[model samples]
Target: MTTTQSLPHWNMDVVYPGLQSPEFAQGFAATVKEIEALVQLFDASHVEKQDVLTVDDGLIKTFETAVEHFNSVQDHVLTLEVYISCFVSTNSRDEVAQARESELENSLVKLSQLDTRFTAWLGSMDVEQLIAHSEVASAHAYALRRAKAESLHMMSPREESLASELNVSAGTAWTKLHANLTSQLNVTLELDGQTQQVPMSVVRNQASSTDREVRRRAFEAELAAWKEVAVPLAQALNSIKGEVNTLAHKRQWESALDASLFANSIDRQTLDAMLSAARASFPDFRRYFRAKAQALKIPQLAWYDIFAPLGSSDRVWEYSDAERFIVEQFGTFSERLSNYAARAFSEGWIDAEPRAGKRDGAYCTPLRKDESRIFTNYKASFDGVSTLAHELGHGYHNLNLAERTALQSFLPMTLAETASIFCETIINHAAMKDADREERMAILEASIQGACQVVLDITSRFLFEQNVFEQRKQRELSVEELNGLMLQSQRDTYGDGIDQQTLHPYMWAVKGHYYSSDLSFYNYPYMFGLLFGLGLYARYQQNPEAFKQGYDELLSSTGLDDAATLAARFGIDLHSEAFWRGSLDIVRQDIDAFCELVQSQA
Candidate 1:
């Protein structure tokens, strides 16, 4: 009965009328006041601050009130930032959006120091003693414990403050420049005796074309575009990593990876275990890749051909049809998830159209209180449909945790993909079940393609970034050196599975991961999420009833515990190579089935 034709754009009017709106002015002024209030609360000279900090007769009441005010201020600041982000993402050429974004960044420059001091002070408190006597303490007990654990490496408040202020111009500016260059850069793809200028987003999406010629041309064009801008991007990567290395040293952390581990609420042992398993499982992955090459009638799979479509899986989905299908498919798993998808579609919570100046990738931004906005370049493909499911999965996760306090809602990135991947799996499985043989082959090929990207490609990224953090400490690397590093990483991870001559040497220049100073090694988390999510899916298959019982708790507890501890609650061992190896076993089985189908039909 629905007559929706075009994809839904997000309603930012509810957040603010516009950047020039008086409502925005009021929120900005209020935020400034709140920031000052929270910052002054941590000032030791203030008598009321001392009384509020101490465990006195009125300490519980005052401290609870203070935390509420702090959260309110943080929320307002974030709301404003999200508005700018949403606007700038959709209209990258809007200088006003970018300016306001920078203004908000400047306005909140004091946040880091304030937050560090507050967490450090909270760490110093008798959290157990306070929790026993205060209801508010009971609510934020885990966050306090986590803050105490993280405070082990807290720099002097002044030092932390200096680092925060320094990053504004140093790391932040470099990243914005990188973003600006990539978003605006156009790629010229020559095809069918004609050349077309397109955004990098569209050019990259062409890698999934069923036509081998188109895919190859798109890949070459993408590399050429990146080559033109690689030098500055190389410098950006070096400066960002160099800054992180310097900051990590100042904080007295053992390594940048150690700091990243702490931020992800995971430990080194788990990372080693995870990587070890991934490395050992490559034989199965190679088998899948080789089968894909066979399906494509190629002797060896070229890097450009990695996403080349195989079989008769050329179904182009309409946006509205995808919305309905995804909602119904989600119901197969949980009514709650299905309901969330329904709400997202009925309400305007998605921006799913390709446009000039729009960002390249898709993401779900969970706002607050059962609301989220999904951004995607939805071109009406099954893959786009799957992406919609993935993002909505994240929204559903947010919905489940909506009742938690602000601090408790800050889940680590490692577990952030759980619900999203789970939802994707559900939709993929449902599609495969109802699909014909050739379509089924396409589904299997698509699944393995995704696995390869996460497991193998992400491994290469982690290695490349780790090496850069080590080398950039000594000196800046040139564009040629960065390319060389990327080539070697691709070769090491892909081995002979990918065509050596056609490997993408400019991948480091194109990836957004290399530029994040705080979020170093953003690569391996994808591998972790993909495999771990499959492992959870396998468990659900075996015992849907029992698995469903603890699923809610698992998602809700993500912000409260370390990755290892949280997995342990579900009887999964994150520190064991066996656990991860077992997870990949699911992929191994899928490869077996896919290869069998290809050979059977050949």
Candidate 2:
């Protein structure tokens, strides 16, 4: 949380003193030493733990005993790795950190190999045997079952190894290239009668500027900057998607979309229902946008104006005030959640500054043995509370899974937003409930504005990616061609609400989601997160006590079951368009209220 008092960057000193610290050196050495033990033990245990269906004490001596130990060493290894992630995130250019990270990554290969072997080994065992094994089996039951199910797609160990190596030079390389390209990007903006070089991150934040001239100039500067890297970025995107296309085809998948579904452990029917629901909800979204345009005193909104603040007083806060608001609001929900945020803020578990090297977005990274650390480029804007709440929501999610085995705590995109978005909804509702007429209108406007982005703008991103892949099949897309596709997607998704002439054409260039070969169509998951979160919030609204237990169960079971299976806990059928539309309907209700508020003033 940002305060008037200077905030400190995350104290990696707790993880280790420094790159040259004995703790860092010893931790890395211990991890490598532990990896060797895991490797030798995994190899030797095969001779002992026969794939017998027996669940006797002899079987426990053979496999389960060894697995519990393996998990212990594995947790230590993870703690070391996550420390490196924290080290590099705030200072990407630390050569010592970078060099050590590369070294640690190489050592991690052995651990990964052992994991694959373990997964494959479990795949051969009968379900009843796993259930009978007790401790380790009960702890990581979902992870083991998921691995066994996915072992259907497993290549040979040697082939899998080669595939990973190829990804390093192929897909991973391009993602890195995109990161390096964007971070180094210099956009010159003429402000206050002088020219200054702006980092791409700083320039993009200007889109939310209250001053229209500044917003327009910033957009222009960002466009100019993106132009310099457009060719390379286009190539980067083409290469990344092309690699996925090649891999999926070789793997006998129908398409990259199919591969994405499998990786997320979700079915095509659910995705179809979600996307179709999004497209159908466009009319209501446009209506909200039209009302917003009136509220902003414009006929229609422009690309830069999309994020522009609507009210005259764009409230900023002291860091202390921000902390109190968040803690009090969270306490209104539950004491457990408030305690997590209190600890995160008090313990310096967050990097809360807008520094040059820190990443643009906020994320909570889970360290299984310890707690999660949140990273954000904090500025005490009106939206700062939402950002803090969102991250703390993630922290709370981590806290729920903290006591569980590391393997069982993995959350996929579908349920990952459950806590974070729900936290946002809680805080948003509280703020709106307490505000005066002027403040209430402003708050609702801001809330609906963000809702428009996730629901409508996210859909536009999905369409743009679909078009990009289709066009990218024959040849690489030129900057103009890519820009054309983006504008068309925006028109198709946003319809007449967003002024076409002022749409962001170079959106594909800045967004890192497009660059990830691993998470194809990274856009819709956010839509799912928002809508899924809303759906759960609705349940909470009905019976807070009943929903609280079910909500915790849902988050805990995310890694255990697929999207459709987990939704069943709340009697949700994700495959039904009606289920998704139910969430959209909630948004429509909010929009209607906002529109009425604005029109009453008229």
Candidate 3:
């Protein structure tokens, strides 16, 4: 197993050696001065409701210049803070180090004021005049439109600024509390005639144990531990959602989903289509779940039982072996992806190891001026290899978009999954091709296990979030009410496949995605990304030579256009159910082969 020592060396010194550096001082002072100047130019009386279309050439040019400068300064400062905080988080455990983190947090909190001022100024622009500014009209037109849409949800500038600041102490603080409680909560799992304190991550992974007794124990202990903190966490979630709803009402918006979707830059039509496809695909999911339950010899599968091993195959790859396997598989599909993965490993780009005090889970952060950075906790298991592919896919996506400006390089949630899922598909396809019968069973089970989580499990989360919003409008949700809603959502999605008695009721409290104040309906985007990526992968399989170029072009163009246009380049129509069904058909084919393979073994 890889340890914390294998993580990337934090290189904040590349920006500046310390806060005392001349570069840091100059950049910090310059950003503050610039923000003050922009605030002074916000002529509230004349600018209110004045569209950029009607603004004179001089004023328009001035506005454009101010925006560019403001964005540039804001991006640089925010990026620097992120780099520093990540460094601090990875290394510092002492009080002084923590105090330094507090300082950075406070500074970032203060900068939230500038965010409100800028948004209000942008909102104050006359619709036509803003649209008519040639510079703004030509480039980043989508961003400009999105800003205007979001601004429509704003209250008076004063209230908006207060909300921005209060969020630091409200939703943000409660989430921090939840993080602390969960990380420190230990489940005293009785194993091997001894009591051992198990972390949540270890307990969750135990559900994959080939030993049924172990999984049952882990599952029971895991949920039991949550009872200790579920009440406070429930309060945290309800409070945050309440604020989101009230803010939406104040802005005269129709719903929280509408505001969130606008920020996500997706439309209701696409969301509805995605949910419909997920619902329609339940039969395929149920088939796989039933097969697994039979294979495991269980009367009925429970939530953790869904990950129960179907075969006694145990194949472990070392870290280097995992890397080589991923790169080779990715290369087989596309040289572009292979080359990116190779560079990510050869260069000091990947932080592919687990460590104490490091944040759990995996992510790939792309630095506009430098190479992308990948983080993961590797346990030398099959899932770890899949994680490597997933994160490297993100790195490759970043590499493809490296030439674009930072503002233009950011892809929305819908299309962000394309490169990542393509990478995963390449690995899964290769495994299916090369593995022996037992190995194939393991790999297929793993893939299906993950897919069900992304599709079926995510569907439950979507339903739960929807119900929470509806009930929240009436009144706040107590812990008991919240748990009931969660179980209902799971039952709806899992149906007869999952035993209701053993379903995870603390799911909403554990998932951090629900706590986000900004991103509502975050659940469905996973299904959209996965199915969309599968559709693209299917196209690539048909004509590898021709489609490879098209795939690369699609990724490069993702930042430049909306999801629909970007997908259309690959002959995909986001609006059509047929398109999503075509993608699900590919997964169905996999499930078919895996079923036959398992039956032959029996």
Candidate 4:
């Protein structure tokens, strides 16, 4: 068995020697001072809502100065926050890190207030005129315009300020509670005739085990452990969702989903188009699921079997092998991407181990423009290798945006998944090229499993969150109610592909996405990213040189425009169902091939 100690831990020393080091302390103090200076700048410039129709040269210069200052301060603030989050996320039991995070959040209330005031001021002024007059404003035209539009839903300055102050104890606290509880959670199971307790993340990773009994035991033990902590987790969910609902109402948004649409910089038409195509592909996904069940020689797939390995592989995907495979596959597309992956590996940028107190799942966060850290709970499986490819894709995206200003690189979640998914495809496709029949079957199964999650499972999550928000508006939902809603969502989307008796009911507690108050409806963007990426990959296949030349530019410009506008640049119509279906067709072809392989093997 691989221990966490053997796996690589990220090098935070490059960012700062330690959280308590003098360099970090100086940076933190300097950021606070900068925030104070920013407030003074805003006050001196009278950066508030205005009734004037046009701006003079003097006012334009003031606006430019304020924009530049705000951008600089924001960059520093994000770096500090990301640095703290690295420690807090890696170990939930770190009291000092948790305290520091809370203190930081509290300190930022004033900055958040200043942001609200600035947005309201922009909302009241002629943003287009300002953009025309100032070079800085012109460069940040999209973000400025977005702020102006968002200001329509803003509360009074005092109200917004108060909300920001209270969030530290309210929504943020609840989110922290959820993270701490889930990270520290442990499941007890009997393996090899001995009872052992393992972290919930470790147990969850067993879902892909080739042994049926191990998967079954892990799933049941996971549910039992969650049941023990369901009450507090339920309260955490209610609090976060309740806060989101109240804020959405106060801000005058139509619904939580409506607010999410604005946050993602996507319109309703785009969402509808993507979902319409996803719904149409449900029958095909079910076919793949049923075929997997047949290959497993099961009557129907249980929830535990969703990620079960479908074919045998004599080779174990150790960490070193995963590293080599990813770099080799990435080089097939572009040298820049390949070099980025190699740097991440050699520079100790990934923390790939599961252990007590460490968070579940995986994410890649930017430490600076040119650097990023990836976290994953790696198991010795192909899925683990694919996860590395996915996150390195995110790192590559960050590298492309290195030259842009902080505000210019603030991409919406919808486009954030593009590079990650694209990189994942590269690795999957490359692996298939050299594999023997059995190896090919394993690779294809892993590929389709990912698509099913993005397409089928993500639909269920979208439905579940939508229902939760709607019900949460009326009142708080109990644990049983949340579980029931989860089961209903699974049944609705999974249909007959999964056994009704074996559906996972506690999924709401298992997934961390639901516990975030700041980002709601975090589910659908993944679907958008998957389909969009596959579509881009198809485009790349048609014209490799042209696509390669423009790919980095597209990533670098994600924050510069809305998702639809970016899609238009590539001649992809986001509003057209056919465009999304084209992406789905790629997955469908894979499903067809998978079904044929399963049948032949059977």
- TM-scores of the candidates are 0.95, 0.93, 0.90, 0.98
Candidate 4 lDDT tens digits, 106-172: 6688888888888888898888988998888899999899998999999888888889888878888
Best model per TM-score: 4
Q: What is the C-alpha lDDT of each candidate?
A: 0.81, 0.78, 0.73, 0.90
* lDDT tens digits, residue span 468-509, model 3: 988899898988899999999999999988887988899997
Per-candidate total of colliding backbone pairs: 0, 3, 11, 0
lDDT of 4: 0.90
Estimate candidate 4's RMSD in Å. Answer: 1.4
C-alpha RMSD in Å of predicted model 2 compared with the true structure? 2.7
Candidate 4 local lDDT, residue 42: 94
Ranking by lDDT: 4, 1, 2, 3
| Cα TM-score of candidate 4 | 0.98
Model 2: residues with Cα > 4 Å off, grouped in runs: 1-5, 46-62, 132-135, 368-370, 470-475
Instruction: List clashing residue pairs in candidate 4.
Output: none
**Candidate 3 weakest lDDT stretch, 10 residues:** 44-53
* lDDT by residue (tens digit), candidate 1, 1-602: 11236767788887779888999888777777778777677563231211225566566665687678667777767677777888888878999899888877866788766777767766666667778888887888778788767776877767877888988998888888788889888889885678878888888888787888888888888988998998889889889989999888887899999898888888889999999988987778778878888888889888888887776656767897898899999998889888889999887888987777887888888765688889988866667778889898888888887777678777878888899889988988998888888888877877777787889889888888888888888999998888888889888889888889999998887887678876888888888888778888988999999999999888888887678887876689898899899988878878999999878866
